[model samples]
Target chain A: MYQTIGEEIQVAGLFKKGRFWPSKFKWSGQTFNIQKITLTAEANNGGVKLRYYSVLASGNLYRLQYNRQFETWRLMEIWCEG
Target chain B: MKGEVGLTGLNHCLSDYKDCWAHVDINSYFATLIQQENPALRGQPVGIVKESGRTCIIAASKEAKLLGVSTGSRKDEALLLAPNIRLIPAQFDFYLDATRRLKRLFESLSPEVQIFSLDEAFINLTSCKYLYRDTHTFGTLVQTKIKQELGEWVTANVGISWNRFLAKIAGETGPKGSITSINQENLDYKLATTKFTDVSGVGYRLEKRLKAIGIENLYQIKLFSNQELEKHLGPFWSKQLRKMSFGEEPNLFEHIDSNPHMKSVGRSITGYKLCNNETEIKQILYNLVLETASKARSMGLAGRQISVYLSGEGRYWFSHVTLPSYVNQNKEVFELVYHYLYKKWQRSFLVIKFGVRLSLLKPETQINQPLWPTWHKQRYLEKAVDELAQKYGLFTVRPASLLNGQLIRPEVTGFLGDKSFQLGS
Candidate 1:
């Protein structure tokens, strides 16, 4: 069970804008900050599928991937990006 | 075909120096070396166990690994999986010797060598272009020489790329006991197939998270725009991972440290038994200050920041104070930390661990010209203390406060910059 309220959390996680920024952040929220996150591929029947996720935070979870050909972030799962 | 990634949690893109880097890691080097030295162990199940009362296998041979015995598994659990498994205690000295020999070999190959650890190094092979046909040939020769001269005891997975970040990834997912050049040749294919953990900088925790996200391979991480990764993962991890994907290196450490100025110097003791009294705790902290201060004196360095940590009852308390001026004298650090700890701690009898940390370190730049006669006397006394400790052993003089039976503590190897105390050879 997670109760998100009135907690001061500081995270040394990376925050990406266009590239990478070393984020030393302090945020007051109801949840633990981004504890862990990763970008990897899903091996499927057809081909490789790109994926993304946040392991620590819960509220704003999204599933968008980078399409090299289109050169854009494509949303695969609606709730993943939210 | 993947090689050993060596240690975990390597941040790839944080380098500040060069563009290209080479990470030549031994492929299951310890286990492989052990097996290779004894041919019978080859093709047999073997695991490297740490020296402990109970067996904790750190690395397993590929064959043993196939039998489902691997790193971090208890010997009992491994035996349950493979009853015929051969367990060997970690030969850290041998591994250290091998690592030093390998480092010497690397130095001969190139003047610039970053010895990351026993089994891994970041080599700047940029200037040695004419010496070898190419990076591939150079990597091959390195691998061959290690195998031939080092008693065929180990094999290396060499990653040659434009940066340490990419070079690490290349070495990690490259062929076993071979080299992989992540350039125009096989970057895409490599990214597409390699497991997320197989990437150089990624770890088990990150891999699990990535897999949960439905992204389980390297190509997907490469596919994400740096912006999206930052927004989702935050700046630090996003930047590091992006660098890993792009094969970028972050030269975080300054290569030149002729007069290496330390950022921090401190000692920590993992308590076997908690100190019961405040006096005992203070004594332990003072001892650490003395030991660390001796080191500072040895190196002619001083620090402005003094920090302390106390852990007990599933909680940790940390406090730090900066001095007005740089001071490496043990008294100053001890006094500062003692005050900080006194204010923050409960003075309860349930303390389990004590640690002292010193930071904001710098060389003693200013010459002493004391205005007060007392101050001049103190300066001379401090110099005498420093000289005595340098000439004799470190603990030749001890503060009277620490004489109470409470302050004497157990030995902690590697506490005072003793490299010999390292667990990983």
Candidate 2:
């Protein structure tokens, strides 16, 4: 199942090879460690360009968005296996 | 018809390609991305539909394909083929984003690259071929970099040749994750072994046409003159076939990339379920107008001709009108479509699908006009609304009419028409 959850969250990551690699994130009073980043892409909402990282953790997929202009992180969506 | 042939201008026979181009085709792009994101789906049959309850599959996993569940297969047919096939909604944004990343990697490898579609790209290796020992070395470099930068599960086939035509064919010939190269030395052999249908432009009907003319392979076209081919095919195809017979990339084939000016901007949708209410149907039409107009506006294009289509319940309503002036804003296009399309439908039962198109487009930059007071006021109002949309989100502020029913969220098409709007939305 897929869920659209646009909630602001806290993310911790490492800067490697001139790119920010998100290692973990906190959402909904729980912490999920990112096992791997499957893909990263930049999208523009109106004029605000944001970067999204698709990460796998805890047997689920998370789409995390980062707006560089505001220095904020938003949890965009999640895919959970049933 | 002359200029319509496409870029690199004139057509002539060219010599063999010595590692001049590389075509990278991401195998089962949408399905692979899904598998990459969710490991549980890696070994299973997967079908990607537009949304829940949507019957048609836009893409299928290699497993599903092997089971005869190809793209365009209905959900019912897919289940018949693979009972346990997992049907997932397509994540267009994710797929597009992945393509962008791949494009960046290709651009880094070579200064010139052609993104044919979401899953395919052609990189001009002419300038950089001197740095590599052979096409295999360069192909391996591309594969290794892809695994390192994208993900281990993401894989592609690489084809290297002198031009885009043969390179793409070579990529298609190889198994997944393999590199295939064709040159003058093996050109005839490759053409002899490959079916005409394997070529990009050749479809089932065209293949039948070729076979009807006693032509079975690409090499046979060379044996016949363009005049003889023209007797079977048209003037255009005869010329195109002559070039393709010699492993030449036809300029006409690159029309989309060569022509930046779009002829039309349109939007179509198949609703979750059929609706019969007049108000509900009108809401959908208005929604489509918003999408079409916004796309044209984003592309800085305005159209003088507008067309609309509605089909369902054993009835069809199609209409088109040439406006007094070109229009690109939502207000103008919506008002016109409402008058020319929706209001004109004498009767309605149910609407399963509908579409709106703006054609005869011209660049907004080319339109120079003296501003009238009313027009100036409307333009300012539109500018204000666009600012709000851009600052907040595309649908953050919508017309009050859209609130009458459930609003349809914006969706992008697989064929990346009006890319500015697709990528932005």
Q: What is the TM-score of each candidate against the true structure?
A: 0.61, 0.89
Clashes of each: 27, 1
Instruction: Summarize candidate 1's per-residue lDDT along B1-425 as a digit string, tens digits.
Output: 22233332122221222345678988776787666544446687887865423367878887887888878898899999888887765544346556667777888888888766557787887676556655556776898888765656567888776666667777887557766666544567766776776665577887776676566675677777878777767788777766656555533433321224556777776554556676777778888887677666656677878888888877777787876777777666777888755557666446777788777777776534337786557667777876664444344556887666534332322112332222211
Where does model 1 exceed 4 Å of error? A1-82, B1-20, B27-101, B134-137, B144-152, B200-213, B225-227, B235-240, B250-260, B273-283, B347-353, B366-425
Q: List model 2 lDDT by residue over B1-425, tens digit each.
A: 01111211111112234448889998888888888877778879999999877889999998898899998999999999999899888877778777778778998998887777778888988877776656666777898988776678888888888888998888887777877777766688778778876798887888899999899988899999877899899998888878888899876457636656778998888887777787777788888898788778778889999998888888878999997778887887888888766788876567898899999999988886437787778777777877787787776778888876766666666656655444332
Every candidate's DockQ is 0.01, 0.61
User: Model 2 off-target regions past 4 Å?
Assistant: A3-8, A15-19, A67-76, B1-19, B223-227, B313-316, B347-349, B419-425
DockQ of 1: 0.01
Fraction of native contacts, model 1 = 0.00
Q: Where does model 1 sit among the CAPRI classes?
A: incorrect
